[model samples]
Target: MALILHDVTFEMVPTEVRLLTAMTPAGFPSPAQDDMEEPIDLASWLIDHPAASYVMRVSGHSMVGAGVADGDMVVVSRAVEARSGDIVVALVHGDRTMKRLRRRGDRMWLVPEAEGLPAIIVDEDVEIWGVVVALARRYRT
Candidate 1:
């Protein structure tokens, strides 16, 4: 299936909570919150460049090693500069794909996290849409 960009605009919801000071352990229960400071807007915290940022639903597992699993909604920012080692949504040969950006001298490549998958060598026509900033996925019940 082809990748689609679903344009989204955020209406700031001032939702804040006391973030726990202690890390919850998987093996056992941990102590309660000792302290937390300031109210934080989760949407603002996640997407710094609000005007140029958007979200998309991921459908592939090629980026699983990068913690971007299938069925996850990834936040992307067009204003955020795309650098080497940054996970980006790009257009390769007219096909939109999500991969890790890698630059070697003057050449660019899109690498997949899966061991058996092959890397995509970017041609002159490639267009980088944006850099992936955050990912959201719901746990199965």
Candidate 2:
């Protein structure tokens, strides 16, 4: 199976697909009383929420422009709506990548967070697995 966002579809190799599903968020949260500042555990919320969850570690600088760098763990939710210019995870040529989603009319482009990676124009076959919701990175001292 592949990831589909809108009309764009991102296909991955079987190994990558397994990796994507295997790496999950750390915790699942229970519900809390209203008006409380307690946060909802994303892992658990995803059970009822339409989005799928994955915790992926950044391994390149291509997305440093988006504050995602090597060693950063991104919390990606597949259920969120992917709008134009949103950061997303996509598979390009059997490889998974994190990039900004930019749509132009019926055409779309994947903008890399890392400098120098050429912008990729996507066809209908491009799969957009999900929108990135939050990023957790370790700061280097």
Candidate 3:
């Protein structure tokens, strides 16, 4: 799938949201808390090196096994060096794609997390664009 990238623009003043001190449990019911912690700046918390990061909306199921789904937004960071096993946004033969980066000795490959998808051997035509820093998803409109 072709990657659709959106530039991240931050406001001059950061927006702070109230943060709860309690951690919500996923497996069992937990006691709720009325306590409020210090407000958090989501943009700062989510995006490290804001000047070198951008957001891209995912458009394929190739990364479903990695917990990244179609329609999710991933924050890509160019400031971070792409490493082996890193989920990266890359330009493959001039086409952009998001995949897991794998390295074996001197060779590298772009591997998909889903079944039946072919892994692409990294060649001179491929360029690692950025490393995936964070993911964002909305359950409802």
Q: Write the per-residue lDDT of candidate 1 for residues 1-141, one digit (tens) a residue.
A: 233445455666668865655555564435554467466777778777777888788876667788987788888999878999999999888878888999978988998777877788878778988999887778885
TM-score of each: 0.78, 0.60, 0.82
Q: Which ten residues in a row have the lowest lDDT in candidate 3?
A: 3-12
* TM-score, cand. 1 vs. native: 0.78
Q: Write the per-residue lDDT of candidate 2 for residues 1-141, one digit (tens) a residue.
A: 122322222222222111123222554343332234444454343233323666666665667677766677666777778888889888787567678999867978998655556778876556887788876655776
Question: Whose lDDT is greatest here?
Answer: 3
lDDT value, candidate 2, whole model:
0.63
- Local distance difference test, per candidate? 0.78, 0.63, 0.82
Q: Write the per-residue lDDT of candidate 3 for residues 16-59, one digit (tens) a residue.
A: 99986565556443456547779998877888677788877887
Top candidate, metric TM-score:
3
TM-score of 2: 0.60
Candidate 1 vs candidate 2: which has greater lDDT?
A: 1
Q: How many clashing residue pairs appear in each of the predictions shown?
A: 0, 10, 0
Q: Positional deviation of 14 in candidate 2, in angstroms? A: 32
